[model samples]
Target chain A: MEKDHKPSSTEKPVLQKVAKLFLYTFLIVIAVVQVLPLVWLFLFSLKNNQEVFNLPPLALPQDPQWGNYARVWTEGNIGQYFFNSVYITASAVILTVIFASFVTFAITRMKWKLSSLVLGMFMVGLMIPVHSTLIPLFNFFLNVNLMDHPLAIILTYTAFNMPITIMILLGFYYTLPRDIEEAAIMDGCSVHRLFFQITLPMTAPVVATTAIINMIYNWNEYVFVNTFISSDKFKTLTVGIQNFIGQYQTDWGAIGATLMISILPILIAFFILSNRIVEGITAGSIKG
Target chain B: MNKVMSDKKVIALYVLPAFLLLMLLVYIPIVLTGYYGLMKWDGIGSMEFIGLENYRNLIVDSAFWRSARHSLLLAIFSVISLIGYLLVSLVLSGRIKGADLFRKVYLIPMLLSSVAIAQLWMRIYHPTNGVMNRLLTSIGIEQPPLWLADTNIVLYSIFIPIIWQYAGFYILIYYAALRNVPNELVESARIDGASPWQIGYKIKLPLIAGVIKVTIVLAVVGSLKYFDLIWVMTQGGPNGASEVIASYMYKQAFTTYNFGYGSAVGFFLLILCLIITYIIRKLTATKEEVQY
Candidate 1:
């Protein structure tokens, strides 16, 4: 094979070099495509409507209308919405991670006859379309007098996120060495203590991963909040921004600022926890 | 250890909270959705038993059928787009520098809420001022297309942002799967005189077939239930041109207060998703997945 290809060996390196360059260019172009819209969004957020219309789309803001952010932050209920998003997301994440951890511990560590069936139920929960449950859930909330309540939003978020949260935890739990857990049990560590102290600490990395994943989901969730919560006081940013943007439909800078505010927390979180985010998402999806 | 581990009371205590939540919120709601489809009731009013009238009407509901078709088109588009993602992942996984940074950049959109993405894309598709038309007009086109309007093109237009939002996600998944292809196999294939394309197509592609199948299911089922972006952007508007199944169901139930009929559509979507998922799983089921 070497003898047959000897004549073209020099040409091969040049061909490979050109191919590699093309591949790099393709990758870079996609990266630009992904990031450019966001940069454009940021630029328009600072420009007045006049500048937004007259200037080139990518041009920087002339005066940098910082007041756009201020107005949206204050004039509207964006601050309220932001706070609502924060606490609701935090509550849901805590509930989901703890509940998922408890269930995962029981299914994986504690011996039980119906363990696989229960685990199967959680796994199947992943595929159930949230839309299918919306109407009934609406009626359920209303009938029980929980409609338009933040608890409805929080509990729904917890329920829907349980499957993926447990999934991310399950892999880590399974791989946890049994020696420590066994010793703890032998020394008469109560089941609750064994789980809370011995197992939970060991799974903290995955717990953090699952926690972030839940936070992102609960933070970005829209359908439940839109359907369940009616009043402005209980609304999250995703739903709050809908009505907020409606009133300011023509105000490009304000609209941009509102969108920026809505997404900034997740963006900041992503920048800080991207590795775990990536790991969690990969673990969550691939196993399915 | 066995005595402690098999503690029935402890097991029930640990599992029941989540288990019951799943039952009430998920499983029970689903059963109720199907049951609700059988009754005639406004969301807040007393129900009158109508049997399967809603389902029968849905069989011939042109608008619902149109939305279902649109969803099918989106599903098809999503599955095809996976090929492009796979190709990009193949290139990225080919020992490229900055692959990590490139993938993370792509994933930024995926992290964002669909509502925000929809609002931003709506501005991007603004008839006169959007960057899309600006680029088109700058290139000397006389009249740029109204992207989210014009029923003929609205569905496809909405698909572009959907692609943008999810491209990174699929790429990341594919990149991970492609990277998991054992290096020794690639090296052996290279030493045996295989070209890069051949190695990628023959070795890497076949090895990652399981991941590819899973993604096909995800893209299709996900497309079928797509709501947020379309809901926020077009609201299945311009005379329902861009309406998908979930959006249509939402409009019926929420917008028109046709709870019974909406529940029927919702039930149909649930069944459709499950059936399609099962069929895809069976179709893609291999004798055995290739183990590294």
Candidate 2:
């Protein structure tokens, strides 16, 4: 197989060009299809039912009624829901990162049989679908009287997400050289000081990356939130949009309106920190 | 003594706190699911011993079969769709400036909440005012089929968004794999008069088989646990045409109040996962571990 640079006798220039053109065309068409829904979502959010259904449905809203958006936020309690979403998602990311980082630190730096055993338990969680064990989890929470509470959903989300967090972080942790850690000991550094000073600073990119990934997951997570948070008081934006559908069936105008509102916070967060999110996730996955 | 805790055993204590939490939350739930699967509790009532009844019911349950069938279909379709998207993405990964731009646009959907995506696509697929139908009508095609309403088409319609949300993931994975292929192999193929397809199949693809294996395993798991988008889109609707095992479990637990049966569904799902994992490990274990 290892030969000199000799052109394949069978290859043709026309066929090569044909293949490249075909692939490029295919990719472009799919890219358009991917973007089309978001475009339509934007359009429908603005138009009333009549215009929405009008022939050759307008690509751009005729009048551009911004009031639907205002109504979506106000009537649906989306503001409160969004606030609740951010609070839960942010806190979950923080707590999970802390718990995951500590485990990664100990597992990677400290050699013990339990490191792998603990990691194995976390991996078991990875394979267990939430539905299978949801009731037991529900009963456990109910026994602790945590139903209809944000704390309940947050804790559940944190527990479910920990496996992935640790898995991804372990990849990063294993890549680091242990020399600095060993050096820290010669200088009388304690575990706490060594982590904060030597390890933590170097782990910046991954921590940022995990934060973005975990935040996206927690923010958009629905199943646990929907099941645990039956009350109007504890709903997040995704659940809120869902409940909006239940209450206002076939009300496409309001439905479209609420859906648009639901994505704004994510859009804001992603756009503001776009650089961080993209780099972080790619780094984690590529390294994995 | 206030000295260094360098004993290797100290690592166990450090990992204990996190290990206990994972046990309480994760391993415990799994064990409880297996235990509850054997009972006749309606989630709230006292547990009654009903050994093998739930499993027996599972065998003859049409709904369970439907859901299991849906899981199989999802796994098959998702893997196939991923392959198609990847083939297209691989061709466009490099040799084009727009690949990164397309990559970004394709990935925008990933950041979106599934419910939001469901709502967005639901409007796009709405019977009368849908963009899909309107585009069809503009080109003089009359009454394009209802995407979500038609039972036969509804499952595929739901898959459209799923493919869009996930294709970017595979694209990135394959692109990374593509980058690892030595340019000399590709250049040498070209110089030897090999077409892109020939070069891709003979060289690039064989080299990247490991990544594809991981991707397929992921696709399998994703298909099984798929809930959010389809639930939001169709809710296994039009007379349960789109239900997966996970959703069926949800329906039993939440809608029908059959907690024990729901737990049994979970046990089945766990077993399914284990079987798949075992198969994948066995398949890969005999081969060399290709680093790239």
- Candidate 2: chain B TM-score equals 0.92
Worst 10 residues of 1 chain A by lDDT: A1-10
Against the hidden true structure, what lDDT does model 2 obtain?
0.79
The CA lDDT at B100 in model 2 is 65
lDDT of 1 at A261: 95
Q: What TM-score does candidate 2 reach?
A: 0.92
Clashing pairs in 1: none
Per-residue lDDT of model 1, residues A1-288, tens digit only: 222345646787677779889999999999999988899999999999999999999988889999999999999889999999999999999999999999999999988889999999999998999899999999999999999999998999999999999999999998889999999889999999998998999999999999999998888999999999989999999999999999999999999999999999999999999999898989999878
| Cα-based lDDT for every prediction | 0.93, 0.79
Give residue A247's error in model 2 in angstroms. Answer: 3.0
- Per-model clash counts, in order, read 0, 5
DockQ of each: 0.80, 0.55
- Candidate 1 lDDT tens digits, B3-57: 8899999999999999999999999999999999999988988999999999999
Any runs in candidate 2 off by more than 4 Å, and if so which? A1-21, A272-288, B1-14, B284-286
Model 1 global lDDT (CA atoms, 0 to 1): 0.93
